[model samples]
Target chain A: MPAALQATLEFLRAYAGPLIASLVIVAVLPLIAGYVVLVERKVMADMQARLGPMRVGPHGLLQPIADAVKLLLKEDIIPEKADFWIFWLAPLVSVTAAMLSMAALAFGPAFQIARDINVGILFVVGISSLGIFGIVLGGWASNSHYSLIGALRSAAQLVSYETAAGMALVSGLLLGGSLQIRTIVEEQARQGVWFIFLAPVAFFIYMVASIAETNRAPFDLPEAESELVAGYMTEYSGFRWSLYFLAEYANMIVVASVATTLFLGGWMRPFASVRWMGWVDFLPPLLALGVAGYCVYRAPRQPVPVQKLVMLGVAGLCALVALLLAVPLLLPAAFFLKAGIHGAFWFVAKVGAYIFVFMWLRFTLPRYRFDQLMRLGWYFLIPVSIVNVMALGVGLVLHWQYRVNLWLALGGTTLLTLLIALWLVWADRKREAEALQARGGPGTPAADSYAG
Target chain B: MLDKVIFYVFGGIAVVSAALVVTRRNAVHSAVFLITALLATAGIFLQLRAEFLFVVQIILYVGGIMVLFVFVIMLVNLDVALQQIQFSRQKWVALLVTLALAGQVGAMLWWAGQPGKKTLPLPVSVAAPAEKLPANAEAVAHSLFGPYLLPFEIASLLLLVAMIGAVVMAKKKV
Candidate 1:
């Protein structure tokens, strides 16, 4: 190799942990995040009693690969009026913005890729906003009407939802007391609880905002197939289109990782053994026996083999929430159990469930009308998330019994929100009647229950 | 040596394109020249071991802002004006202003070099080699949070105001 090449290789090898980890995360993250898309398709398909991608791989596991290949092999066509350079540059920006958001994700305790950052959440939110610029610019640069409209819709949708998303995230940071993913996870584990239980309102708001942020389900009006031809992607075809898809799914996984790290006890199993606590003994001490047997006198590769490959691949995960036994916290057994609880399975399960919800929404719900989508984002989500943030803020300042108080506060907010909603509905109906009388035409249909 | 080669190529592109930025007759052509200059500047940043700035420069300036500029130029239908004879009555004044700006730059450079010791490093020394630059977003964040916190907040607020201003300016009614 040339000296320059040699130096680059040396630097890579020297920082193998993070360098290799990042590569693996970027590479394999898409593979599994595709499973997220597949799960969405399958769940919706199965919900509708139709199979999704059955012919691709065994049980359609290879569907993402097949879809990717199809997109790649397809011919790339550019409009004559298109600015070729910006057309090329747009998707690259979107994908990089999407992928870089994952840099701060903490998978499990002691397993983070880079642990020193104090403002990981802030970093993610800032990066996530950058992705919208691509869609907006791509539409404008295409010099097409359809793309422009789609891009404008996306710009509006993203800006509106971002406020809600920020408020939702801020609530969690207030409750969790640290912006660092592992630190939050650790505090959750030690407190013997998850943030979802305490911050249920925030959790609900987060889910709604995140779905909107990822442009999933009913919020996917920007790319409504029947309407804007593929939204901002209307003009893009082949590999350029594939880059947009990559960014979309990568973004889906970023949200999943964020939700997992924040709301779930990030890799902490629900039922950790009490004897492991040395306080109670309902379950027998099978953990030690299993570890030993799995390690020696049996197929050493069987159990950990599965976890190790994933662990090695995603080396820098957020450390799992640790259960600190009074003694020998540093001992290997304690560490192993802690890691096992907060490891890939927990992350996969949590992230997977949220992703399932994503697919479920896609299959079940019809896309929103464009104006309805905008109004819903601006009026409903923005208010609810702000109220949620304010409730958490009040709870924190007042030193309320947070776990119980948050639920009560959520209940109260729901009731108050319902009452306000009813008042708005009545007022809207009165205005519509007056308008109809004024125009000598029948008033528009009454607003739906969910309508702003 | 590779860094020097890349820098020279990018710098040359920057200079030529910058000239084009000023002198291109068509507005759309001038916009395209500006985009090229921005990209070449990003390439120079990459050559100077500032990969994060390089990435942001390309992503933001070239990709985001310049694309918007190109779109605006296209939307205005500058291509149709190509056949029209266009002339500025103040051409002599514009030339004089250009010469005056050049003279001002020359004077500043001469004044800065009056100590007889070079401040800026020579081209070869400025860039030792080309490789991926270390990017520590956290360190940047830390610096912003600790020392530059006020400016950072001010910048964010200014950006928010700019966005609002754009919306207001574009709106048919307030």
Candidate 2:
């Protein structure tokens, strides 16, 4: 081989793991995003008492694949007056930002793509925030009124909620004492508690702010179907639209992972540091086995023979996973595998739970109007998060400076924060009442209008 | 070799996109190019191992400030603006000022490059190996809060004043 070729090979060999991981992520993420969409629809259906996409495959298991095929094969459209370059570029920007953010996220103790950069969590947060450009540019390039409005709303909403989200993350970081994601998780483990238990208010703020950041309901005014006609995505069709969809789901996962890492303890099982709760390590394989068992139980109940076989295949897949999970625990020589495997299981489980809550909220609540959404973010969430951060800081000081019990300090501060939150709500309500009076009472048509 | 490749690639992108930002006819296009330039600059920062600065550049400059820029540009009637003159008649004066600034920077670089000559006090080399460096974010935080605390606070205060000024200007009856 030429020297250049040899040098290239050496470089590739040096970074082969990340290269393969990146390749796998770039390949699998779209499919994962597709399945996330399926899960969302299924969750929506369950909430609404209806079956979702049952005809696609057994229990809509293959619906994402079907949807992917349809989207890929569909006609690509670009409006005549649209900015062609930007129109082409927007979805790629969105997906790139979303996926790039995932590079820094450690899914398990052994699996981190960017290898825990100094500013890992910050990198994730910042890059993911860059996805707003995709929405903004797409909306603008479309040259449509609805798209423009949607993009404008999205930009404003993201900018507003991001402050609160950053502050919330700061509250968590104060406890973690580091910007690196692995360090944050290790801090949680060292402390023998998740930051959620210490900083519940910050977690709550982060949850609400993240939902807004991701543009999920009830904060999803930017894409309100009843009004915006698919919002910034109005002009997009076919693969372009699917790219945007993939970006959205990817962003959801990114935010969920951030929350998992910062608050829920990344890759660490509950009571991870507690020796008495060592039994929790066994929960992963048992949970997988349980899932497998459920699949087997439901296999024979399928209407068709093919469906039954498919169900059985799924059961077998789950069983294989259970076996893989159990092997490290069963054998002493394979003990090194236990942390990586179990950690991944717990990390993914927490992220799944977080995403489930996101979907649950989407199904359970009505969408907020634009102005109301802004008010909630700027007025409620921002102030509460700031207060939460300050209170948490004081709590930490008390725990450190005065040698107060950590839980007691945190609990007292949380109570104080809650009181302040209550006061803020009351004050906001009073202001609203006064504003209503100024607007000639709530009975006026203007007062009742959805002008926002 | 990889580091040099990455640095050159990002530097080239930054320069090209910065040129594009000024040359683009459409306001939104200009804004988009500006964002690309900022992101490329951020990549260069990351290459230099200034991870905190890299993220701050993306978060603060590209994400926050550029969003506002795009938002404002979208709100304005671009057709009206595009129809107007793209540049003012200050080409000669602008060229003179640009040349002066370039000369000053070139002179500084020449001074810094001079071997065994101490024309200026140089800071620690940022290009030191990663293992030799302290954690980037921690070093930044310590400097900002420890010795440079007053300056940082003043800067924040200046920002707060600017924010209040903006609100005041925007308000109808303030």
Best by TM-score: 2
- TM-scores, all candidates, are 0.66, 0.95
- Stretches of candidate 1 above 4 Å error? A1-10, A271-342, A400-452, B1-174
| CA-RMSD of model 1 | 9.1
Q: Provide per-model DockQ scores.
A: 0.10, 0.78
Steric clashes per prediction: 15, 0
Q: Per-residue CA lDDT of candidate 1, range A346-442, in tens?
A: 6766787887778777777888887777666666667767766776676565456445555566556545555654665576567658977776554
lDDT of each: 0.69, 0.91
Error of 1 at A207 (Å): 2.4
Q: Residue B101 of model 1: what lDDT? A: 100
Which tens-of-lDDT digit does each residue in B1-174 have in candidate 1?
Answer: 455667788999999999988786777557767867987887787566554555567656764566556555546655677766666679899999989999997876776667775664435344332223233344465788999999999999999999999999999698
Deviation from native of the Cα of residue A35 in model 2, angstroms: 1.6
